[model samples]
Target: MDVQAVLKLADELVFAKTGKHLEYLEEAILRGTIQGQKYSQIAEDFHLSEGHIRDVACELWKILSDVLEENVSKANVRYILERAKFYNFSTIGNDNLTINNVNICPQTPQSPQVTQQPQETSTQPHIDLGDAPEIFRFYDRTSQLTTLENWIICDRTRLIALLGISGIGKTTLSLRLIEQIKTHFDYIIYRSLRFSPTLNATLTNLLQIFPQQADIPQNIETQISQLLNYLRQYRCLIIIDDVQMLFCSGQLAGQYKTGYEDYQLFFKLIAEVNHNSCLFINSWEKPREIAKLEVNNNYVRTLVLGSLGLAAKEILKDRKLSDEEAWETLIDTYQGNPLWLELTASTIQDLFGGSVSDFLQCDAPILDESLQAQLDQQFQRLTQQELAVMIQLAKESEPVALPDILKILQLSVSNLVNAIRSLVIRLLVEVKEEGKTTFFSLNTVMKEYVKNRYMR
Candidate 1:
């Protein structure tokens, strides 16, 4: 269902008759219609004003209508071309008409026409998932994988959270899962929020994919409604990676950047409102709205990824590291984090003659230079209160109670509450509920890194 090819043929025909090739802006506007995108979106992408874009579009449509001897506009352009027939040219000598089936000549005035011809086979599930990287290999996550599958297919979950710290295989697992369940979806779009694209930009790109809807609105609320309409109309699976980017750095968890706060209402609607489609977010931290809406329902589910166990040994075996006895200790010491293991295993192979025993004997410090650098990227975003809480947690062998932490740090109740909540949301601190009392502690990797370096 790619309209790019059809539009290219039409453009060639246009050039042959008018000596004037379609201008860059004109071409972009046409392409937007084919992809079912809105003018506001097209304008925003090209840095053109809304009024100016429409003016250009009107002129462009007039030119196309005259060139094709048919009614041509952004709305009916794709419909007309889909049903039109192409033929060899004899009208202009030496001007071969190899390209056909492009022009807006719909018969009815009631509504846009749907061609009787069946749509072409699926093309990479509607979104720009074509550039997605290969998973290479996946370890034992059969139980977790099955749970997610059931959640999407059987339980009809509209919102699913794949939450874990970096390098726990969140992205890889998503890629693998989509490949398996793509058959069930009418449109599957995968977008990365790593760059923190605005809700407007994200929706603009999204609307274009579901080309059935021609004119999306300029208003943000309208845009959300338009998306919801599509979700109800089509069984779409939208997967957004690196969703934590939407959260404001140096603030408590779930606080979005100023302009991005609309995403909270957006997520709330997606969870509470009914729609056939589902959204899967792979993030280090859950957005504030999600934390509130995450009730124990089949419709909303969250999966937290932990370390990979025995299967990680396969990595050691392939790396040709010696001493099976030391592998478990190494895995446990580092918490079997896939990325950490990959980095450390390679480092050991290069530096320690592939001897797990030698690496264990040194046991110098768990956070190597590379691993620390990775952790630093996330740690740099933490606030002063959050850092203070981490230091307090590192002092305890057992999880410390809230009152004990407040006393030890001699902090205000308000500061302690905000810091603990933020730290927990950021996945820096783990919490345990012991009857009426609550406890907090840092993970081995964080405790070791903060203690040796900052605590020193």
Candidate 2:
């Protein structure tokens, strides 16, 4: 949809709800989002502070949320507007809903069950992958890739999570997979939860894509019911990325931020309830409910992504390292994380003239200024407890018992346990089993990072 068309629809909705169209700055902010401009850029254009732009966005999202009866934010407002336009043209004022290519009207019985129909192009699948990131140079993750394909295409898994640390290629893998299997669904939508759009807002944006029923549900539960109804009626592949954004920073990893806690029930229902649709999430940290529900549910699976093995040599290849023999050692030291390799490769090239051996001779210093900057961003997201736990764990030469960690930190046992758990979730700490006990240790890179920053 054109940006102007979206704004027009938004204006109409806003007028209907609040008896006023969007103000000029609101429209500008909306336009900035539509154009994919950063708030900093938008602020510069408008002679406003980035914080002020955020305030404007909050107000705009709130107003749109009120009008649409769903949470609306800069990240998702365009999608909602586009889907609402489709609803307006096709089914909003009508009574019937399209179920598996059959239009069920007011007279038809609403059945909890649905029949599977052959894939046909008669009804176009409502696809709105809003600014889905591009697949740029994905390393070999063939087995994991195949698993994702089987889960979505053959097994028809309803909810699947792709879990990994940041820059471990989750986003790129998902993009490639979506392109491969997009035709299998009647509807395809992708949204980033990076900015923590409200679950209500996300639901509304998705609901706008489906054929609307005459009596619209106002509350979230009813709205979710309507979405479930559509999921049962049509094949939807909804991909939500960066789900960790919904989680609260500076707290336990699984806990949601205020007002986002409802997302737990939302995801739980999507996993447990019957629906012909699949919900795919790409996340840095696992949600609490996902951990519990995925235990016995084959329909729900979480794939943990580790560093690339031999394929990580691709980074060295790209960087044109002078010593090919040292690539394996370099890859191991950095755990084959593409982002880390990308950053480290450059530092190696600049300082050691692309000679990995020369770099290795220096003992692979873990905390380069650039890589430390990256770790800093992730570390900043940790709670005080999590950060303190990392500090103590970094000092240990080997995996230490929970009691050892407890001895160093001035925290109660429960709090210490929670902090360690949070650290584990953030992928900052690793667990080793010795005899019957589990011990905690920081990865080499993380140890250097925490030691450099906290100890020094």
lDDT of each: 0.74, 0.77
The residue-by-residue lDDT of candidate 2 on 1-456, one tens digit each, is 588877866665555444466899988988889888888999999898987787667656655554443446666778877876676425433554442244434333333222342232346667788878666677788778767876665455788988888877888888778767776678888999877889888888788877777556568898888988888777788989999888876778878889998888988999988776789999888898988998977679889888888899987898888888989988888887888888888988888899999988986654578888877767878888888888888888889999988877899999998888888877778888989999988878888888788998
Best by TM-score: 2
Q: Which candidate tops lDDT?
A: 2
Per-candidate TM-scores read 0.70, 0.71
Tens-digit lDDT string for candidate 1 (1-456)? 646666665565556444456788878888887888898999899988876676677656644444444446566777765543234222223334432332222222112212211121345555457446667887777667777876675455789999988887899888888877776677888888888989998887778777754676778898888998888777788988888899877877767888998888888888877677789999888786777787644467888888888778887887899999989988887777888888889888899999888987975445778898878877777888888888888888999998898888867999999989888877778889989998888878888888876789
Q: Which parts of model 1 have CA positions greater than 4 angstroms off?
A: 1-127, 296-298
- Scored against the true structure, residue 204 in model 2 reaches a CA lDDT of 82
Task: Report clash pairs, candidate 2.
Answer: 71-200, 71-201
